[model samples]
Target: MTTTDSTTTSTGSPATAELRVDRLETVLTPTERPVPAGPWTASLVFAWRAILKIKHVPMQLFDVTMFPIMFTVLFTYLFGGAIAGSPREYIQDLLPGILVMTVAMITPYTGMGLNQDIQKGIFDRFRSMPIWGPAALVGALLGDALRYSLAAMITVALGIAIGFRPGGGAVGVLLAVGLLLVFSFSLSWIWTAVGLRMQTPESVMQVSMMILFPLTFASNVFVDPATMPGWVQAFVDVNPITHLTTAARSLAHGIPDTGAIAAVLVASVVLVAVFAPVTMRLYRSER
Candidate 1:
């Protein structure tokens, strides 16, 4: 007599046992699952995630680092004498302009990343998690603070190399940077909302750049408002970015613009108040 050995499963039935055993094989197999993180925990994840993206896409640094240096070099060499009458004076004047513009340009990327996340369905996954309700988004926005600080410091270092110096001592310098980050941080929410609502990241980029470019350029960046056309002068004087840029220049070179500093502070506070809540609302809806 010939005998065959077979394994028994949940059921003694031969065919059923084979089916059950096969199912068991699948259940026992290893599989991958995404880890769940809460809002606060998600914030930490988002922050590190942003850092990792920055590392992988090092080219993104081109705008913050290279843009300032290139523009400074080009403008100083090409238009310094014509515009400011001398390279040295141009460097001094242009440094503030470049720093402000650099910050302005770098900020839109905050929206770009948010838009990408929304498009990729990452936000939906975030919603499913029991983490801090808005913490992940807030953390992502905060992540850009590091980028802004790096850009600001690098731009100032470049300015120093080209003979620009902040007359404001260490305290003033710290204040200036603190103010810049505050302004940038608050402004970040507006773009974050845009990203959440928008479909394409590119659209967010274009719209943000259009809004930001004019704001920075129309400010007292490279030239005095007196030279601007009357209407332009009115606009420039009133631009909130002008106040901050002027304040930053004051902190750097002792320009004595107390009113500008106050205006910047007020505007930054307002921007944060207006946009942060809006962003959270939008995030809640989508979640």
Candidate 2:
């Protein structure tokens, strides 16, 4: 008699065999779930990463550090005698303006860094990861706050070294610095928008300078608006930088001018409201 050994066949439906196949399928395929992180926590992580990057690339901070020193010293001495009768007197005015200018000048780097990441595929990778949508930009801005603060400190220190004293004392100086940082943080959103649209980091820098130079020089930063031509004074009257400088100067001198301060605050709000959404949209579409 011929007997066939029992074996499982396709036609043979055994419950144990089905269970084995199900186990095999489970083993063959794996599902990945993204780790959960709160938006603020994610942003802080990105900020920390950015700060660490500065350790490897110290030159990234060169502009914030050296520019403040050079501009503070140069403008204080070069135009001091003519502008304010002496360097000592001029710095009281010039230092506050320089603080604003330095922070404004460095704000573009936030965009440049963002553009570089986009070009390098880092931003693309970030998009793929599970995190808050605005975490990258928010974190970068947070990191830049440190840079702005550093520039402010350097400018004030250099000014003090050269006989520039704030009539407002420490409290007034701190208030001025705080106001500058708030404005600079908002101004960075504009560059962030520009950077998202630009093809290269260099282009972002170029475009930023184009927008910044007029705003910086045409205002009351270097000289009193009263000294400027009538035509220029008209523009200065509307220039947001002039308002910020005026506010900063008043705070530094222990003279509180609520109108100028309110103007700067309003301008900052408008800038962030206008540019922040544009930046986020561009960032989402980058891939």
Give the candidate number with the greatest TM-score: 2
TM-score of each: 0.83, 0.87
Candidate 2 residues 16-42, lDDT tens each?
A: 455586578888887786676889988
- State the C-alpha lDDT per candidate: 0.79, 0.90
| Candidate 1 displacement at residue 148 in angstroms | 1.1
What C-alpha lDDT, on a 0 to 100 scale, does residue 110 get in candidate 1?
Answer: 79
User: Which stretches of model 1 miss by more than 4 angstroms?
Assistant: 1-41
Among all candidates shown, the one with the greatest lDDT: 2
Candidate 1 local accuracy as lDDT?
Answer: 0.79
Show pairs that collide, candidate 1: 38-131, 38-132, 39-131, 39-132, 40-132, 166-252, 167-252
Candidate 1 C-alpha lDDT tens digits along 205-286: 8888889889988988777787789999888988988888888878767655888888988998898789888888888884
Q: Give the Cα-based TM-score of candidate 2 against the true structure.
A: 0.87
